[model samples]
Target: NSGYQQQPRQQAPQQFNNQNRIQSMNQFDLIPMSYAELFPALIEKYLVQTRASPPVLAKLPW
Candidate 1:
């Protein structure tokens, strides 16, 4: 009876350590955005910057 009671207490720490190790290993994998997701944001930022700027003198023939 006592062995069974102690079994759960020992297993809990092992399970927690395994989960922590897995999370640490995965943390870096989660930080970066895939190019498909990042490309649209880059395009939108470029468009916004171009729209905010005045037209170039060269673009105007006058």
Candidate 2:
């Protein structure tokens, strides 16, 4: 019974993190490539707004 109780406690944080990861992925998916071409400067603006680091920029295909 105690093991069952602890199981949920451990799973709760993992579930919460998965939810956050999914939400961020969804947000990124919503941004179309056309938008990047339409407003070139907005890409830099977005990176700044999102507080992305130089290492992150290097990883991006753009």
Candidate 3:
């Protein structure tokens, strides 16, 4: 029980830092886009990636 509670406390800051790092690394990256803004572009990108690469995205733990 104590370990479970500690997990989130540790992960929350790490995830926030990762997001900040990504945004800082690329000012024009898609982290801030809404669904409507992403619809057309995201589909094209997703389709291209699936065709160009193996389906590694499906193997994510999440």
Candidate 4:
């Protein structure tokens, strides 16, 4: 039996370039930060402000 030939992949015209991607990112004024650096600060800023009334006793595995 003969196998079907694979088709060539096409790159979309709206593909992102570095400057465009960076420009899009800049719209958020976001700079990449290490998870180690951002996580603690984020947790501190958000978790400290959070009040969990009748806090969760346990989470389901699912």
Candidate 5:
């Protein structure tokens, strides 16, 4: 056959998983946005949701 085939004697090096690499990226929470930057409905919904959430003094895990 003229088709190329891998040599059984050769071994490919293992590669690191992308999931681990992506997770190692810097963590950022809650992108900044003003009411003017958001749709009117979205702004109103976010305000209502935030108001409804209980106030707590707990640190979030990154």
Candidate 6:
């Protein structure tokens, strides 16, 4: 009835060190300003050099 015995204990699985895992973020440059800031400057520069055409009216939705 007691023929089987507990097996000898073994060390737990080895964990990977930080050095082993590849770096997630390797950014080499900083983020520039968003389109909102850049677009206005571009539009202003274009308007100064180019003339605007007549505007077309459109129906408004309620």
What is the per-residue lDDT of model 4 for residues 1-62, given as tens digits with 9 covering 90 to 100? 23333333544446467667422221233335554565588878885455568866598668
lDDT values of the candidates? 0.44, 0.38, 0.43, 0.52, 0.47, 0.52
C-alpha lDDT of residue 15 in model 4? 48
- Models sorted by TM-score, best on top: 4, 1, 6, 3, 2, 5
Report lDDT (Cα) of residue 48, candidate 6: 34
Q: How far is candidate 3 from the true structure (C-alpha RMSD, Å)?
A: 14.9
lDDT by residue (tens digit), candidate 6, 19-46? 7833243334422554455457778888
Q: What TM-score does prediction 6 earn?
A: 0.24
Regions more than 4 Å wrong, model 1: 1-31, 47-62
* Clash count for each candidate, listed in order shown: 0, 0, 0, 0, 0, 0
Per-model TM-score, in order, reads 0.25, 0.16, 0.22, 0.25, 0.16, 0.24
User: For model 2, what is the error of residue 27's alpha carbon versus the real structure, in angstroms, after optimal superposition?
Assistant: 6.3
Query: What tens-digit string does per-residue lDDT give for candidate 3 at 1-62?
Result: 12211111222232346346522221233344455554578777784243465666756787
Off by over 4 Å in 4: 1-32, 47-62
For 1-62, candidate 5 gives per-residue lDDT tens digits of 33333322433455478555322333344324543444465767775443466777589765
lDDT winner between candidates 1 and 4: 4
User: What is the C-alpha local distance difference test score of candidate 5?
Assistant: 0.47
Cα error, candidate 5, residue 1 (Å): 61
Number of the predicted model whose TM-score against the real structure is largest: 4
On residues 1-62, what C-alpha lDDT tens digit does candidate 1 reach at each position?
A: 22211111122222346346422221223324555565588788785243467666866565
